[model samples]
Every structure is written in structure tokens, then in C-alpha cells.
Target: MLKELDLARREAEVSSLAQAEQDELAELREWLAAPEGAKDEHRRIAGLRAEVKEWQETYKKEKASWMRAICELTKQRDLQVSRADLFAKQLGQWRDIFQETDLTNLEQEWDPESSFYANEDAERRECQP
Candidate 1:
């Protein structure tokens, strides 16, 4: 439309009109390519979003793995602490029992010919008869 309008008004300036038409065509081509360039930019934005989503998913997976590992370690540590506490209580009781026992009297009583053993044997014989 512009070319035809300009041609009708500028019959005497053919060369100048031709140059103006070429310049207008170049401007129109650039305008037409704008949407296509925007489409390429949109594609690049979509690709970047996809990459970000992939990285976020990987981070979530790794965080979950680390949480599981920490939970497992905590459970193991608790179990070990409980076992150690139980062992400590049992050892304390054994130590108390050992400290209360008279090792010298126990050894003497263990001898068969000791007077305490003889007295026990006499009591047994009397009970049997």
C-alpha cells in the first residue's frame, strides 16, 4: 500500500521512490522477524525453567537422603547409649554384691573339713533320721 501510494505521487523521482521502498521493506522484514525472535526467547526461558525444576528435584532427593541418614545415625546412637546405661547399672549391682561378700569366710565355708561345714552335715544327718 505504501509502495503504490508513493509510486502514484512520485512518478518524477523513480530512483528515490525505489530506494524508499527498499528501506520500507527492510523495516517490515525486521518487524515480521520480531515475533519469531520472541518465540526463540520463550523457548530459552522454558528450557531454563525445566533445568531449574530438575535441579530442585535433585536437591529435594538429596535432602531426604541426608535426613534418612541422620535419623538412622540418631537411632543407632540412642541404642548404643541405652545399652551402655544398662551395662553400667548391671555392673554397679555386681560391684555392690561383690563388695558385700566376705571372701575369707566364703573360702573357709567352701572347705569340707571346716567346722561350719561339719555343723551343717550334723544338722542334715539329724534331720534325715
Candidate 2:
């Protein structure tokens, strides 16, 4: 009879433990359903998404503006290079004229009886220092 009483007591103790475990599990589920950390994490993710969208917009505008500036600069550079090429061609022409023409022959040909000055030369002489 004592053994039977012990067995009954053991069963009752196990049943109480099982009930306590079930109550603890139910409380844990309730806590998880409305967790403060989960809510905060969701808000943080939303804020980050908004920030990323703003960054993308800003980046697009900046990229477009930068590309326009680069195009303008490239055009200017091309114009400058063309001007330099034109100047170089003019300088080559002048150098060829100087190399081919003899200053001594010009002086010999400039006698008052044999040669005459053009109207432009007269005007140039008038302006000379």
C-alpha cells in the first residue's frame, strides 16, 4: 500500500511539472508575438530603405551633371586643339616664306629706278617707328 502511494505521488509530481512546462511555453509564445526588438528592427530596415532611395536619386542627378560637364570640357578641348593646329599651319607657311626668300635679293631689287613700292608698302612705311 505504501508503494502504491509513492507511485501515485510520483505521477502527480510529473503531471504538475508538465503543466508548468506548458504554461512557460505559452508565455514564451505570447512574448514572441509582440517582441519589442522585432518592431525596432522593422523600423530600422524601413529607415535604411528610405535612405538608400534618397542616395540613389542624388547619385543619378550628380552623375548626369558630371557627364554634362565632361562633355562641355571635351568640346572645349577639341576646339582648343583645332585652334592650335591652325596656328601651327600658319607658322609653317611663314617659316617656308622666310626660308625661300632672300633678303639680299630683295634689297638689290629695290633700286629707285628699277622698282616701285606698292600702295600698301607706302602705308606700311608711314606707320613704321
Off by over 4 Å in 1: 1-34, 107-129
Relative to the true structure, how large is the alpha-carbon lDDT of every model?
A: 0.76, 0.76
Give the worst 10-residue stretch by lDDT in candidate 2: 111-120
Which prediction has the highest lDDT against the true structure?
2
Name the runs in model 2 displaced over 4 angstroms: 1-40, 107-129
C-alpha lDDT of candidate 1 relative to the true structure: 0.76
Q: What is the lDDT of residue 70 in candidate 1?
A: 86
Clash tally, candidates in order: 0, 0
Q: List model 1 lDDT by residue over 43-129, tens digit each.
A: 576578569768966986797688679879999999999999999999999999999987887775676666787989888999995
